[model samples]
Target: MAQMNMIEAIRSALDVKLSQDPDVLIFGEDVGYFGGVFRCTAGLQEKHGLHRVFDTPIAEGGIVGAAVGMAAFGLRPCIEIQFADYIYPGYDQICSEAARMRYRSAGEFTSPLTIRTPVGGGIHGGQTHSQSPEALFTHIAGIKTIIPSNPYDAKGLLIKAIEDNDPVLFLEPKRLYNGPFEGDPNIPAVSWAGHELGEVPEGHYTIDFEKARLHTQGSALTIICYGTMVWVAEAAAKAAGIEADILDLRSLMPLDLDSIIKSVKKTGRCMVLHEATRTSGFGAELIAEIQEHCFYALEAPIVRVTGWDTPYPHALEWEYFPGKARVTKAITKMMEG
Candidate 1:
């Protein structure tokens, strides 16, 4: 196994899929000649040829619409939206067409399209570049929403999403692209060069869907989160000097309720964390589920440490982000109760 950042891991997954399955193709703006704005698709166009790994027009709607059409015709089109914030133009194609293909056709047709986009804030991308709209897609009736917290999981889960015969929204946390963020903007995030999670396999590997990755075992508290928040929660727990059991939800639609319930029951304290805004965020759904399943086991009110219910702040990003100070305070409060 070799150490790989999230970008390298994702590229490896795409490379393996393109080589193994001729039906698989990748296309998006700047993904061809420029190899994507983030260079995730660099060298892919030359390696797989223009037809297999090419670039698309700037029209997001047309991009997604074409993907839907290609998927129906027995091709696995792994399309990228460049940024999650720019995916709204293609929302109709994703929710209305690809998501409902199987249901509308009574299982006669299935839209196996994989939509990948970079999400979350870390590089001062401001409001436009750094919005976590994952909660929006998770609310849709059809389609699966996935967010992997590390390079290893990113490679495996991406491969799974690309192969599945359904609409899959793969939200890549931009904050964790090159390193693991520990909920602090002041401290530089360490690179994944020597980290265990950065060690990815060379060949094809698919992690099971709807499974939660448990970080640590502890009875003090259970911290449930996904994407970049998973690392932040662990850091918060360490800073607070409280042993916390953290669960990284790799997929949102097909949630791992069994793991959640077990953890909450054992800890008797739960907290949902996310970079998305507070109102109507994915944390709300997690809290609702925890309330329903572990109502009796709760010793304290389920705490939620999330971003404020406002647009991502450009000047005060750290204040808006639920950083270590915020998460640690929540942990302390939860423990006190």
Candidate 2:
């Protein structure tokens, strides 16, 4: 085991994949020479040479479009979109071309590619760079959406995504890239060096993309969240003095319904949370599924703690964010009912 930050762990995953598989290719804006904006792909270009690890133009559409073609021709292309907020330019290629390649070709061709991008707020990136656009991609069919909360899951899930036979949208919470955040802006940021989740194995490993990790088990209520919100949920549960079952949904697409239902049944209440906007957020789908499977077991109406239906504000980041205070209030209200 090696203590590493989210950036180091991700770099390790890419390095391992590039070395193990000759078909794997890494490319994106500044990903080769500049080593990505977050430095997740640093040192890779030098290690693997410019051929396998290279840079691309600033056009996201062209980047994804080219990756789709590469994947169709039998190469595994892992491309970065810089930020999840900036992935709109490549939306058509990801949703139309790469996602539909296998099904459209009757299993004759598959785009085994992974699109990695930093997502979420907390760095004062304003509206453009701070949006958590997981819902946008999750709404699209034929694609798997993944978000990792810590260094361990970041490394493991990324490797799995790169190895998957279909295209995967790997969303990295930029806020949690170096340390875990639980919605408390006052808490000093701690590097992964001393964190337990930062102790990632320096090897080739994969966490099942369909599994949801249980952070804390309880019967009072169930908190279902992913990405940066996982830490927020944990802190909320503690602050609210609620014995909550916190489930970190690493993969949003092939959601671990089994685990979710089990927890909802045991807890008899559920609160779906995310950093995305509340309207039509992925939490809505989770609420629907929970109601379908465990409606009778529910003790109170399902609740959701999410961002407001407006553009992420730069000056009012904390107010715009669905933090521990909001989550705690919701949990308390649900328990009171």
Candidate 3:
């Protein structure tokens, strides 16, 4: 085990896959020479050689289109989109080609590719760089969406995504890449070093997609969240003095419905939280599912605390963000009911 941040853990996962599998290829805007914009692949190209780990043009569509062809030719390509905000350019390729290759070809061809991109706010990136477009990807039928809140799941789930036979959209919360953000910009940021979730295996290991990890257990309420919101949910529960069952959904699609139902049923109340836009966000689907399954078991109506329907504000990042106060109030209200 090593005390590593999310960036280091991801780099380790790519390194392990590159060394173990000859078919694995890593490439993107700056993944090769620049070692990724966030430096997640810093030393990988130098160690793996240029062919396996290389850079590409700033064309998102061509990059994803080419990766689909490569995957068709039996090579597993793990490509990065620089930022999640820029993924729209390649959205068609991902949704049409890479996603449908296997099913369209009657199982003769498969797009075993991983698309990694940094997402979310808290770095003053404004609207251009700080968008959480996960719901768009999750809506696609053939894509598997995943978001990790810490170093451990980031490494393990990434390796698992790379090895999967279908297309995977791995969304990295840039805010949590170095440390966990508990929705408070006032408190000094805490590094992942020596943190419980920071200790990651340096070897090849894969975390199953449908399995969710329970962070805090309780009978009061169940908080279902992923990515940086996991930390925010934890903080909110503590502040509200609610012993909540907080579930970190490492894998968004192929969701662990059984686990969600179990937790919601046990608590009899639930809240869905995320950093994405409120309307038609992934939280809506979670709420719908929870209602369908846990309707009889539910006490209070399910609540969702999410980002606003408007674009991420440039000057009002914190206000747009579903912070601890918003979450704490929701929790208290649910508990009081």
Instruction: Report the number of the highest-lDDT candidate.
Output: 3
Give the C-alpha miss distance for residue 282 in model 3, angstroms: 0.5
Question: Which of 2 and 3 is the better model by lDDT?
Answer: 3
Model 2 per-residue lDDT tens digits across residues 146-184? 999999999999999999999999999999998889897
Model 3, 62-115: lDDT tens digits are 999999999999999999999999999899999999989888999999999999
lDDT ranking, best first: 3, 2, 1
| Model 3 misplaced regions, further than 4 Å | none
Runs in model 2 lying further than 4 Å from the true structure: none
Candidate 3: residue 242 Cα off by (Å): 0.9
lDDT of 1 by residue, 118-187 (tens): 9998778888998999889989988999999999999999999999999999999998999999878889
Q: Provide the global lDDT of candidate 1 against the true structure.
A: 0.92
Q: TM-score per candidate, in order?
A: 0.99, 0.99, 0.99
Off by over 4 Å in 1: none
Q: lDDT scores for all predictions?
A: 0.92, 0.93, 0.94
Q: Write down the worst ten-residue block by lDDT for model 3.
A: 121-130
